[model samples]
Target: MPLSAWRLRLLIVSLLTVSFLGALDHTVVATSLATITGELGAVEQMSWVIVSYTLASTVLLPVLGKLADLVGARLVFLSSLALFVVASLFCGLAQDITQLAIARVAQGVGSAGLHLMPQTIVGEVTSPRERPKVMSWIGAAFPIAILVGPIAGGLITDAWGWRWIFWINIPVGMIALALAVIAVPHIAGRSGRRFDIVGALVLGVTVTAFVFAASWASAGTPGTGIPLLIAAVVAIVGLAAFIAIELRVSEPVVPLRHFANRTILVCIVLSTVIGVGLFSVVSYVPTYIQMAYGVSATVSGLVPIATVFGMLVSTLVTGSLASRSGHYRAFPIFGTAAAAIGLFLMALLPPGMPLWVPMLAMGLVGIGTGAYMNIIVAVAQSAAPRTDTGSVTATISLVRQVGSTTATAIVGGLIGVGVTAGLPASLDASTLTPQAVAASSAAVQAQVAELYSSVLAPIFIGLALAYAVGIVAALLLPHGRLSDELEPQPVVGAENAAETATA
Candidate 1:
């Protein structure tokens, strides 16, 4: 009755594939923002589309990761996938930015399930030794999806329309859903414990408030300050309550025991740093190109390809190295160090330099960022007991999300508005008026690019500092291969046929 080897492998692939749908949706919207803004009159509200989706995913990752441990992953995985597809439909059909933003919130909730659950599902189905190789596929899928997103968006938006961006997810989501139901392993919920309602509420509010403050810190100078202060107060109060509730609750939402491991402590610190760099790079690159070089949206989307290519290139090389040497620490150490250097180098570029120069700079950062994931995540999970693997995986992810969101907010604030007060002499617009600015927005957009390029260095430097911390942590990680004894025990089957299948 145990699943055939083929079915198990198929299940892993299916989960990663569905997860990729959610990941792809994140980046695909970046290049098409201009079109969405123009059509929906959402210039000011445009940032929310990215922030909301990311914030939702960040907040839910820890909760859902723990949920996967409590209730079986099979149920949670399918439900999340179904929600993502439905939300995509709503997003595509939205008439206004407000409607689209609301739909995006739904999409974000669905995406959290897709993002966190797949890793847990993979852990459930594959042995610890086999997990690295399978996880490589998952890690690789992330950059590939991100890289392809813009190209696909450009082609679709240019040929058909922006709606196609969301529309394309329909077929992919359904296919992943069908495969998951057919192929994924069935897991049952753990018994004898109730959901920690007080803890869940407190943590949820804490994450929500903090994420909003961090995500929207760049909205305006005056606007961001008070809200950020309020959010800080809410986060502190909520976190205090969460800790108190967890201490008293018979069953906590996140078991504090999981944080006791030294390795996990190191991994969490490193993940936060990596998160800051990775998210900062992804969020700013497209805007950098558009604002600095006066490129069209379609053209701007292509800039990320350099980073994507660098990531792909490094992944293949380092993966082979890890496999050959059977040592993982060296890769992350090198990767993070290189990434810090790359980010610093990017800071040196003058505003509005040639396209190829900036592209190469981003590529360097990509190479470094791409190399860190497999090494760190694998190391972190290996450090925890088997029963806590899902928890550890989710924890790293949660830290990264918080780091990235925090980075975006900080960078957004530093970069100020992506607009310049002066236009270049080469750009002749003698009749520049507010009315004309509205009609011929492209000209105004050009000035913004010049300003953005000039200020990109400081953002990269801040990112560089984060990656530097990650490198230091990677160096301190204990060096050894993962052992099965360190893993969680496998579940016993419920019936004769189920037992046979599990066997």
Candidate 2:
């Protein structure tokens, strides 16, 4: 069916609303992790909750996206949203860390659909000329969710308990599901293509292994030794097999032909670096705030507000500039420089400094993050042919997730090292407590704060290094813009008929 412009817009918005919930929940539970750990008696497994979700999401992103293209995005999206709601309920009701971790994996699987399907929907309805503007607007929702999510979660967790973090998704998901069913246009996939089952399994195991290794090592435990080694070896083998398989398959999950485009390859690498810096810094900032200032969970949650504000403003400005001038080189260049500078400044926060200083520094980080948000995707898409748009978008998403996961592992390890190294040798590891140590009159609280501060600085500096890598990658990326005819178009025969009948 030939869809009217208004109807298409309605459909896209409805889909994005659902998409926003998926994206929002990704970080909502982060700040409340401590509370969850205490209640569940599993503080050590805290990072796994975060890692499992990201690992699940990262592994499935490209696979699910390819499946959407093979089957139908409509079915995948609705089913994923439904699963997200159900999984969230399970997460809220979980009696153990294992249950919570499993629930998170399910949520992550659902998130893959949420992250992918909407972009497909957007592409189907909007024209190439309008895509940048429309994409810029659609992108706004994700950041907006990020900006408010922590505050919302903090309030909910503080008032109702951490369980509400999962419970909150129920209403939001229901609304999104209702809207998606009503307005979303049905788009079918290319038939006769086999879903690369082996490839998917390899990718899943590799991601899970790598994530597990990172989380284990970060826990400052000796048990992680064998697992980390095994994970690394398996990931290397899995990746090699995937590359070999993709090159031979007629309908490969990852289109190797696209890699031939030097520009797209460079952009993917740069995005990976950016993801490392962005997620590591954003994910751990609250921990720093909590330790450095001894702030309450609710108050510490506000620390990210500065970063969110900066992102909001910079994104709007840069997006408009790109749309109007059609020149995109400066975004990443300025973004990387600003990010590096911001991270360096953050590292320099003197011991016991007031909260405002670090908050201001986060604002700078946000500026850099916002500046490059869509520029990477835009460059990748423009470098590819029209038919490759979905894969191209999915590629960047996958790359970013890998980078973020790697960074989380690296930074978490660094933080652990700093904390461990700074502790007095006379202190007992198993029964250590900030207050109890302080009572012993051994300069306990001061020493603990000092160790945390020392550790935090190096993590921030590594994040700066990641941004520097992104700058180099951005410089290497080829220059281009979207074509005039890039807007949404109907698939020639049956799919269009299905859409029309629905209309």
Candidate 3:
């Protein structure tokens, strides 16, 4: 039996809440990192707070998807929510940075399911024609969370304390859990399929090694040179091993045949490029605003909201349009072009211009980012066989994670190189701070601002080039009506039928 319209709506809300919580936690933690470190007294291990969560989340994505297929999506989703809530409690109670890091790893394990299962559920519930609209809402939660996080983190830290950031999730998690219990259907999982344990281990190791290497390289922390090199070598070897293992496995963690479809390959490539371009803006623009304009962190954070608003509007509108027309290629093509234009405008803006100028530029980039978000995933999911949906979705997510990590590393390198090249030899470029710039003489400030502007121009230029490549990839995407394929297996069990009737 199909779900009642109201029940379906409630289920979507539950899923979106989970998505928002997962996305919000990351950004909130990012905003409060300085404050957390000040009290925790473990500056050396601070980055792991983030790294642990990211590592755990990235490693578990494919495995969780496999579990959902083998067991059930509802079970996996509820388990993930429970783990996340418990981890949040532990994180709030953590007395040391190490404890917090471990708690975060557990949280990340839950987050992997929070992030991926919603889409899987939506796919199971909705036909291909209606998926874009629902997914757009799910996808919008991420950017909205990003937009809201810093502001919320700053306020919460100032009023209550940093721990409240974790504590806050308890109530939200409870409500989501209740709604999930009432609304989610119990779709059966496939039996007799072997879990790809070897492939999972190899891929997990490869991703963890790469994440650590990227973090080290990007951080440029003192005395990490040898460790960074070793991690990089390990990542390369692990990746090779993962590929070999996947090819030979009876049921691979990521099915290789999916890539044979030109649509999936093109979407993957475009997704990588979009990840580079999109994350560059999200990760670096605030720093650019502060350094270039001498604005406070709060004020700098507010500017990205414009981008988020732009993204919100486009996501809803484009998703509705795509749903109606059953066409999606145009969204990515147009969106990437707009993004390239936006990045170019941002790069060209003069230092210390009125705030609105930069906000407008960011809004353009946000539109592009929104366009790519749900549509690519939808395209990739539609392109794959019904049985392979979970694996395919996980693979796309894995590629995007790799792209984001690589982009962060690349952007960090660019900033380092630019600062070194632009600053005077005596400046001790590494020691320079926004306060130092504010305290400098007019001439010095001008010189510093000019250096930052020059570096930023190239960074945005690089971003534009990345989106331009995405535009080409998007053009190559296969054109067809979105597939209306049904799950090959039918829902069974009298108990499930009775539950659906009662709901």
Q: Which candidate has the top score in lDDT? A: 3
lDDT of 3 by residue, 300-356 (tens): 866688888888888988888888887888999999999899999989988889888
Report per-prediction Cα RMSD to one decimal: 6.5, 5.9, 5.6
Q: What does the lDDT read for residue 48 in candidate 2?
A: 80
Q: Please name the candidate that would achieve the greatest TM-score relative to the true structure.
A: 3
Error of 1 at 241 (Å): 2.1
List the candidate 2 regions with Cα displacement exceeding 4 Å.
1-5, 31-48, 92-100, 154-164, 217-220, 290-302, 424-450, 487-503
Each model's lDDT comes to 0.72, 0.74, 0.82
What would you estimate as the lDDT of candidate 3? 0.82
- Per-candidate TM equals 0.83, 0.85, 0.93
lDDT of 2 by residue, 1-503 (tens): 44687886787688668867887897688768899989999987787898778778888888877776777677778988999999999999999999999999999999888887777656545443344455666667677888777777888899999999999899989999998898877776776877778877877787777667666667657666787788778878888988988878776677776566666676687678767887766767776776666665556656677887787788777777776666666788898889888998888886668888888888888889888786566655655544555666788888888777777777867776776667777676456554445455436656766777888887788788888887887776555544444432222232232122111
For model 3, state the Cα shift of residue 246 in Å. Answer: 0.8
lDDT of 3 at 470: 89
